[model samples]
Target: MKQINSIEDNLEILEPFISGLNKYLEKSRSLSLFKKLPIRDDKENINDRLLEGSYLFSPCGVELRESECNSLALELIDLLKLHLTDRADEINTISDHLLNEKINPHSIILSTIKNEGNEIRKKIRQLNLPEDLFTFFLIYLARPFREQAASYLLEKIEKLIWLYGYCPVCGHWPVLAHINEESGERTLWCVCCNTKWKFKRTQCAFCLNENHESLEIISPVNEESYRIHACKKCKRYLKEIKSNNDAMNFQFDKMYLGTVPLDMIAEKQGYIQESILTVRYDNPAGNELLMYRQKAIKEKISIN
Candidate 1:
């Protein structure tokens, strides 16, 4: 509930709880690091203009197709899954270390699994990707400013938050994730980097609604400290909770989404969420009626 400047600030305040996410949420029942992966061509032959009035942008941005992203993401997730199990803590530890110094945040992501040891890479190698395409990944990992890439990626993802209404990373809509820390309680994990962001407990992520009638509380209502917030129009939900101790669970949204049974229960109660934290993270300028989007601004000529 303490106000923080940025997502990173919230993560800092919730550090102890994030560290303990592994223990509180058993990894066994958790979704694969690649949960809800889209098939490469899931949106094939569909026109995108239908949603243009809604201020939605394709996450691929003409660089790639939805299918291509899904395929690449699947490949990448496979890599993380192959290795994330035993090395989850190590990878996270190194990620935090790099975050501390703001070093090569992406490359500094410590993977205990050797690159050569990854099965996905072996499969990719077998595919014989063109040198340029294959090398792009290597360059991405070793980019000069990884934090820039992370920021760019994160910002780009924020845009897609509206399009698909799901976390760009895990592809899983949040169920009942908890922050598990004194400060980070009821925060969400970036479906991509698995980063955590502390959002206001009662506010709606899409429309920013706090009206009691518009929002519904689903499962885990019995926990006293936590409950689900669902917006019917937005088709999204997030968990909010109270905590007194500092928690070290890094598996923030993982455990939250793992409660499939609870998700079913919520869905049955006539409450549903198709996305998480998408609109809230993206640019205020990007929405329809912004300073740049105004028709007057478009027609006006420069006085200078």
Candidate 2:
């Protein structure tokens, strides 16, 4: 295996997967699917499996057996059932043969750069979930794949959205951030929409707060480069690194991947938000902006 020297290089490894994604996008963005998806409403709520998605955090480095993936898929149906009469026991059963250690629900989502290979995408469609869910599942995948998969899911669902619309994609909300890469041009990338708009990276993305007093930079006791960007105007914050060494041009998506624990601390202080991924769970993938917390997946281990 060769080391990836740049983000562009890593993204290339995903070309085969991205190529397939281009087709999924053209077929998915339909208004009919976005208007009113038929899932159990709050008052009519009766499904048990539906709750699982909200709680579904695909664990890391964990291997899921075909039995487990199928079982979870069954749970997905359970989660999908809008009516109590829906029989996952009869209509939806896990294909015991479909399990593969690679079917990482967590890894799949995170590989925003890598669209699930055809086998996984085919398996996802096999679940027969509401169209919105497929979108969420796709974008919720934080990997670069989400970048394209979310685009495909939204286009399939037929929704009109800007590149940087609010965190409408996962229907999750956003906790805002300010990123200033090299050109001194700061872009506001919504965790949900995958939209990038220009703003003063130094100013608050949420409230445009400029007072140095209103903003605070909280750093870890030991780590010098990493710090939290907190704003008093909106009472929101995000994380950033001002390093002495510029060799590492940090991409936030990849940068924040290993820093879940720090996000927890930021949220605890009420400095900024964490899961402000989107407003609704139904929003198509990649469109939802996400914080580190929403990206948290429990540690998974398949005993089998």
Candidate 3:
């Protein structure tokens, strides 16, 4: 793989993805799905959950009516199709299939398998559809809801979040991590819900293994601000950004975009990205909060 040496190169690689994201954020911001969202009372208490070793509700656990989710998915498809030029024809087919379905967020089978933590690729082998489409749809389709939660909960709990590894709110593992320049404290960043929380510097985010000898740090020559934290036990890697003056000015999303080289290098060394299998709350397709909304659907057919 080619090394990316500058911000321009990173933008070249990430432009397609980032361009669509801004539009998705803007359009979704205007939706009523966020208005009077049904956030369970305890979900907002970030510090409380950390103290008890309990996780806040995953965004998937939040209930927005199906119609709104479907609408968000449809809006996302327009932006997604633009970025997925290689899969344009396949994406069009997926779009058609989605529009024809009465259900929102489309692809119930894939979503169900994803929620159940089943091997989706093997289950959908006969379908022959592009797996990328399914993955993107499942992730971004729920963004509208997740972003809403982030907007509210991030500010609601005005305390120093103590948990380090997984997100306190969404329960998903982090996409990126960074260290404070002064204190040298580390924090993990969640892309799914845009969450940032403090974690132990020496501990591996995946297994919580703090044996310094079992952990490795990979840094490129001349790039003092960025490094890869690899845990030998879990074989999972986290991209870490050191919060220097210049680094502090860069947005986390932009930093994530520019770190493509880091991800490639880490993966080449046999370390996979850090992602935990999100626990299911209720139904096969979404969070347990969907249970209330899914009563009619559940009555129609058994999930198992």
Per-model TM against the reference: 0.36, 0.38, 0.74
lDDT of 2 by residue, 167-241 (tens): 323333333343443554444444433533344556654444568888887766565445677787667776665
Q: Cα deviation in Å at residue 259, candidate 2? A: 2.6
Evaluated with TM-score, which candidate comes out highest?
3
**1-304: candidate 1 lDDT, tens digit per residue:** 4321332344454454334433322331232222122223223112232122222223331222233223333333334334445555434443443335433322222110112214323433554433332332332232112222233334433332222222333222333445555454345544333434444566564444558787877645344444566776555566544455443454444344334344455566666544222222234422232222223322331221
User: Residue by residue across 1-304, what tens digits does model 3's lDDT show?
Assistant: 5655654466677777786776777787777664345355554455655664444554343445566767767777787687768888877876876776633353452243234445544433645567656655665666556666666665566664554366666666687888888888777876666667778888887666679999999987677678999999778889888876433344677677678788887888999874333444343553343233234333432432
Q: Higher TM-score: candidate 1 or 3? A: 3
Best candidate (score: lDDT): 3
Model 3 whole-model lDDT (C-alpha atoms): 0.64
Deviation (Å) of 131 in candidate 2? 21
Model-by-model lDDT, in order?
A: 0.37, 0.39, 0.64
